[model samples]
Target: MESETYRGYNVWGHAILQQEAILAPERFAASGTITRNNKLVEASGVLGLFNAEAEAEQAGLAWALAWIDSHG
Candidate 1:
């Protein structure tokens, strides 16, 4: 799990290890998880798909941070 810290929460990125063949073939899916005080607060469901893992991580981090900003 790759992660970033934002507003006292740990925003983590999850990579798709096993992709289903029926989904979009050109993109890879990723999710985000938010942890605060060593506890899980939120988990984003399939936030994005991208051509590269780095891209997915970037997008996931952005989404998680935005969620924190809006909901925190």
Candidate 2:
């Protein structure tokens, strides 16, 4: 079997994800805006002491911006 990964998530269980993207062509396009939980997203992109709530929120926006830099 060919091995590949997308967004760090294994594609094996991603058939549903593929289906979702296919169903919503716009959402699957190269660039699109989508909403997510502030708590979950806040930790990824911001720089600060870990576990800091306010910092996490800022980091999340940074995280998303970083993602855009590469994905765009």
Candidate 3:
């Protein structure tokens, strides 16, 4: 996870991984979490999934910024 400060909020990029079966495969996804004043304000939700970490981080940041604009 990487944290970025944006407009007084700390936005974190989170990677989500799920293993369907021991011999199957693992799936990857990502989302954003937001904190303000050291307290959690928002969690991982509404953010779209991506096949790559970079794409997910980019999308998560965009989503977080939009959320802040509307809800801040």
Provide the TM-score for each candidate, comma-separated. 0.79, 0.31, 0.73
Clash pairs detected, candidate 3: none
Say what the RMSD of model 3 is.
Answer: 2.2
Measured with C-alpha atoms, the lDDT of residue 17 in candidate 2 is 13
Per residue, candidate 2 scores C-alpha lDDT tens digits across 7-67 of 4322111011112554544211111122343222211311333333333333434444555
Q: List the lowest-lDDT window of 10 residues for candidate 2.
A: 10-19
Best by TM-score: 1
User: Which segments of model 2 are wrong by more than 4 Å?
Assistant: 1-51
Which one is best on lDDT? 1
Model 3, residue 37: C-alpha shift (Å): 1.7
Against the unseen true structure, what C-alpha lDDT does each candidate score?
A: 0.81, 0.30, 0.75
lDDT of 1 by residue, 2-69 (tens): 79889899998866754567684556578889999999999889976788777787777888898999
The alpha-carbon deviation from the true structure for residue 4 of candidate 3, after best TM-score superposition, in angstroms, is 1.0
Query: In angstroms, how far off is 29's CA in candidate 1?
Result: 0.7
**Candidate 3: segments with Cα more than 4 A from true spot:** 19-26
